[model samples]
Target: MAEAGWYPDPAGGEGYRYWDGDRWSAQTQLRPGGTSAAPGAGHDPSTPIVVKGSSDDDEDEPRAGLWSQVKGPVVIIAIVLVTIIALIWALMQLGVLGNRGPGPSNPTEFCPAVTDGNYSVDPHPRDGRVYGGELSYPQLGAPWSAPTVDGRVPFGRDVQTQTITIEQNYRPGQNWVASVLVGELIDGDGFQSPEAGMDMVARCIVGAFYGDSPVQREDVTRRPMVVDGREAFMLEMHLSFDVRGLQAKGETAIIIIVNTSGSKNSIYYASIPDNAQQYLPTARDLVNQLRVGG
Candidate 1:
């Protein structure tokens, strides 16, 4: 029959327990410094000590308090998990974990997507000399004119020699002619060796140049040889296509990556279309006759 107030614990603990008007509650508090009599034993009715849970106790409050106690740790654990995942991704990017061999992380590192502003068709030298006289090739006759140079520098490097290209003039989707590209051998970002660089450049050319057409590549050949007294890597393939607007059915393409002086490299690309299959020998001769200067 005690009024709702804090009283000495009936469980004989050194603390006060909350007693509702009807029953005892599980709530407890530190014992106050004072002599107190049990409730309903002539205790001062006006000086009743109130503790928490003396009023209508909410059952959900205990669960909510328990959640509050553990909420910080749960949030901390979630943050730690996110940090670990991000660190793993960074390591993978740095080639520390889940390494994928020596290749460019991005496909565009060597052969970027061709945009109108990234390339040009300029008049080349008529003397067959190109790249500031560092290279030379046989000049084609009449229909071929002088090979027009298409200068393309990768996205980052500002050097004009990053890629030096020259090709015989021909109407796209109508005729095909042989072309050559000389790329500087970059050391980092997956260009560790001549062979690796050759592979990346070859694949980039196929995707960037013929991606819009339904092209099929076959008869791929890769080898190591010496060109102009320097070590070189060569890649050759036949590409066949049946595009609606294109007149030629296929072409034989070649890529030659040669190491030059000062650790530089030259890339020679040649494509002779099926329509010009008779010129295949001429193309091979051109490859065989490549000359590279310092």
Candidate 2:
């Protein structure tokens, strides 16, 4: 054979052995710079030897290289997973993904001492058809005078002229009282517009108050106001009437005309005495709270 080939020792020892073409021989040597000697005598028995092709150092080098190659990707994947979990937890805590607590609210403060419980929903005692749900009136113990009825039957003369009347202290022998009158009347077939219907209501009211006395109409002012989210016409006028043979200065009358609750085109009339000026703001606020449907 060409020279004695280097081969692993056949005795399962850790060293290169000089092998003739067919077999391992006793001529052996250590790798790199170690001395060469007979196979059984070359190295001390306790000395470590490295096999030519299969060493612990060779296996450890490949494993360390593999870890270095994949280290960045593995760390990136772990960070992304942690961030997603944190975001989901934060959203759940903020109630964006679940039911949490109430946000905020507002309270009605019309009068200084008024609250929602101070008002009561009162339907008409006699006529069940007429409904004024939740009439926001002053409580019985309040400072202002409680409402009452005038001498006249609150309901008007015809089926077309049903009325609901409220007044402030019409005592046993009082000369005058502040009043509020809400009336529903039929719309005339010939009355083509709201202006015409308003004119007719004005004529009727003036006739009732004037009653053959020499009447003086002063400052007949008309303006637009809102009632229950609908547009209403407010007509304010001052008149002097004959009472018990003496010319008495009547309270300034403010009449608000709007569409009726039940009728398609009929008029709903609301009148307030200007003498109740102190209570006007409170009254307007209370009317704003009126909801039509029961």
Scored by TM-score, the top model is: 1
Error of 1 at 5 (Å): 99
Q: For each candidate, what is the lDDT?
A: 0.58, 0.44
User: What ranges in model 2 sit over 4 Å off?
Assistant: 1-175, 190-193, 245-247, 261-291
Pairs with steric clashes in candidate 2:
121-134
Global CA lDDT computed for model 2: 0.44
Q: Candidate 1 on 171-246: residue-level lDDT in tens? A: 4433344454443434445455568776567666666566466455554787998887878888788877765655
Query: In model 1, what lDDT does residue 203 have?
Result: 60
The per-prediction tally of clashing pairs is 0, 1
TM-score of 2: 0.38
Query: What is the C-alpha local distance difference test score of candidate 1?
Result: 0.58
